[model samples]
Target: MRAEDEPDLVRVSLAADAVFAGAGVELPPDDPRTLLAHADRVLVATASDGRPCGLAATVAIDGHPHLEQIAVDPAHGRRGVGSALLAAVRAEAAARGHGRITLTTFRDLPWNGPWYTARGFAPLPRPEWGPELVRLWEAEAGIRVRPRIVMAGRPG
Candidate 1:
């Protein structure tokens, strides 16, 4: 991702949040600039017009790759953009010698939990959470009201 792609990725993230809002789920406020600043890698998926339509950002946690955020413009939903972006992240993580990828998401959401499950992720037992993952879960406690779960998958 280029410096110029930040704004478009931010736009896509916020637009995708609207989908959760529409479902009566209120997500914690997030700053895209902060997210990008800490991201180890940002993968962008562009539309046919060459405009960004989705993105996946990753960070390292306990020597493994963790997906910090993934968002797709609702306009481009169900067109494989999200899947492709995830695949790219997984490949990158694998190439970097990371054994697995981890993430947290609303457990009940069709697109949040089930979607990843379909793609090979499984709920991570809390007992397996590392110190960093525990800190992350705690950090999000007050900010997010919806039920969330951590999941992990071997990066293929």
Candidate 2:
């Protein structure tokens, strides 16, 4: 994603979250900039009209990579945008020599935990998560607002 894509990306992300999560969880204005600055890579999926349809951000920690955020526009659901973004992030993680990729999702939501599970991620015991990720979960409004399942996938 380019520097100019941050606004649209953030917009799509916030919109998707609001639709799926029923709460307006917008990133801080500078959050996208910070994510792009620190992430191992950021990937976005756009529609034919060039509007961002989905996005994913990955960052490395403790020699493993974690998918920090992934969002797909409700209008574009089941059209493969989320899957493609995930594939790209997984490939990027493998290329970076990361052993595994981890993510957290709403346990009760079909589009959240079930989707990840369908894509090969398996539920991870909370005790297995690192302190950094645990702290992030504590800080995340959505995760704190609802019960979530943490999952991980090892690169094959």
Candidate 3:
């Protein structure tokens, strides 16, 4: 993604979040910028005209890839943008010698947990969490009220 794409990706992130609001999951309104701010690796999906319409941002956690956010504008949802970004994220993580990708998401949301489950992730036992991951889990708990869960899968 180019520096020029930042604004559009931010827009995509915000617009993609409508799904959560519709689901009655009231995420912090200030979250997208904060999450995107810390992302070290970001994959962007573009429209035919080349504007960014989706994004996948990842950061290292416990010395492995951790997906921070994967957001696709509703206008582009259900068209494989998110899936492509996930595939690219996995490929990049594997190329970097990472063993697996980890993430936190709402456990029951179809687009959150179930979506990833269909792709390859499984619940990561809490006992397996590293110190940093435990802190992240706790931080998430401090910020939201939802059935959040941690998951992992090989970055193949």
Candidate 4:
């Protein structure tokens, strides 16, 4: 993602959040600027107009690339933009010599857990979690009421 893509990417993410709101999920407000600025790697999918329609952000966890967030504008949903962004992130992780890509998501959300499962991600048993993943799960517990799970997918 380029510096110029920041604003539109932020808007796309916020627009995607409307889905959660409609589902009666009260997600904590996230600052896209902060997310972009701090992400270890970011891949964006853009509309023909050159505005971002989706994005995947990654961070490092125990030497592997962890998908920190992924969002697609509701208008662009079901068009494979999210999948493309995720694929790009996974490719990046593999290129960086990471064997797996990890993420945390709401366990029951159709677009969260099932989507990943269909893409080859599997629930990583809590007992198998690394220190950083455990810390991340604990941190999320304080902010989200919905059940969440950690998932891992081979990037190879």
Candidate 5:
């Protein structure tokens, strides 16, 4: 994605996530910018017409990779965009020699937790999260107002 795509990417991510989840779970204004700033890699999937359809970001932490955000435009949901973006993240992690990738999502949210679980991410005990990840979850807890489940997956 080009620098010009940042606003639209953030818009699509927030809008779609709100639709899929709910208003209270929406991303804050600086959240996408922060993710893009810290991520070692960012992958975006576009539709046949060249519109942004999905996005994912990955950052390295203590020799492991963390999948930061994965968002799919509601209009493009159930297509291959989400799966393809996640595959890109996994491939990028493996190429960087990371042993595993971890992420957190709302435990009871159908689209949030179940989607990742179906793609091979397994539930991880909150106690097992590294310091950086723990901090992230804590920050999210402040914003989301809903309990989240942490999950991790090893490269296959």
Candidate 6:
């Protein structure tokens, strides 16, 4: 993602959060600026007009890329934007010499856990979580009421 895309990160994230509302899941508002700034690598998917429609943000965790956020504007849904962003994250992780990518997500949300599962990620049991991942999961649990799972997938 380019520096110019930073301004659109918040917009894309909020638009993507609409999915959670539609699914009857209440989530705290998302502000992606901080994460965007700190991400190990960020990938953006653009609309035909050259505006950003999706983003995948990752941070280093236990020496591997951990997906911090993946958001696609609802207006651009079903266009493979999210998938493309994720694939890019995986490829980038591989290029960085990481064998796998990790993440935390709602266990049953169609667009959350299931989406990752369909793309090759599998649930990573608590015992397998690294110190940083365990801390991240615990922190997330304090703020989120939904059941969440940690997952990892090869950087294919």
Candidate that scores best on TM-score? 1
| Per-residue lDDT value at 74 in model 4 | 92
Q: Give lDDT tens digits, candidate 1, residues 1-156.
A: 899998998899899989999999887787788888899889899999999999999998877899998899999999999999899998888888888999999888999989999999999999998999999988879645778899999887
**Candidate 2 segments exceeding 4 Å error:** 21-38
Clashes of each: 0, 0, 0, 0, 0, 0
Give the least accurate 10-residue stretch of model 2, judged by summed lDDT: 21-30
Model 6 — TM-score against the truth? 0.94
* Clashing pairs for predicted structure model 6, backbone only: none
Better of 4 and 5 by TM-score: 4
* Local accuracy of candidate 2 as per-residue lDDT tens digits, 73-110: 78887788888888988888778787889887777677
Among these predictions, the greatest lDDT belongs to: 1
lDDT of 4 by residue, 1-156 (tens): 898889898898889888998988898877788879989878889888878899999999888889988999998899999889888887777787888989999888999999999999999998878899889888787546688889999885
Segments of candidate 4 deviating more than 4 angstroms = none
Error of 2 at 66 (Å): 0.6
lDDT of 6: 0.87
For residues 1-156, what per-residue lDDT tens digits would candidate 5 score against the true structure?
Answer: 678778868877776666744545654445577677777877888888887777898777656888878888888887878888888888877777778889888777777788888889899887788888878877776546566788999764
- Clash-forming residue pairs, model 4: none
Tens digit of lDDT per residue, candidate 3, span 9-59?
A: 878988988788898888876657676678998888899998999999999
Candidate 6 Cα misplacement greater than 4 A, ranges: none
Quote each prediction's TM-score. 0.96, 0.82, 0.95, 0.95, 0.86, 0.94
**Model 2 TM-score?**
0.82
**Candidate rank order under lDDT:** 1, 3, 4, 6, 5, 2
Q: TM-score winner between 3 and 6, please give it.
A: 3
lDDT of each: 0.90, 0.77, 0.89, 0.88, 0.77, 0.87
Better of 2 and 3 by lDDT: 3
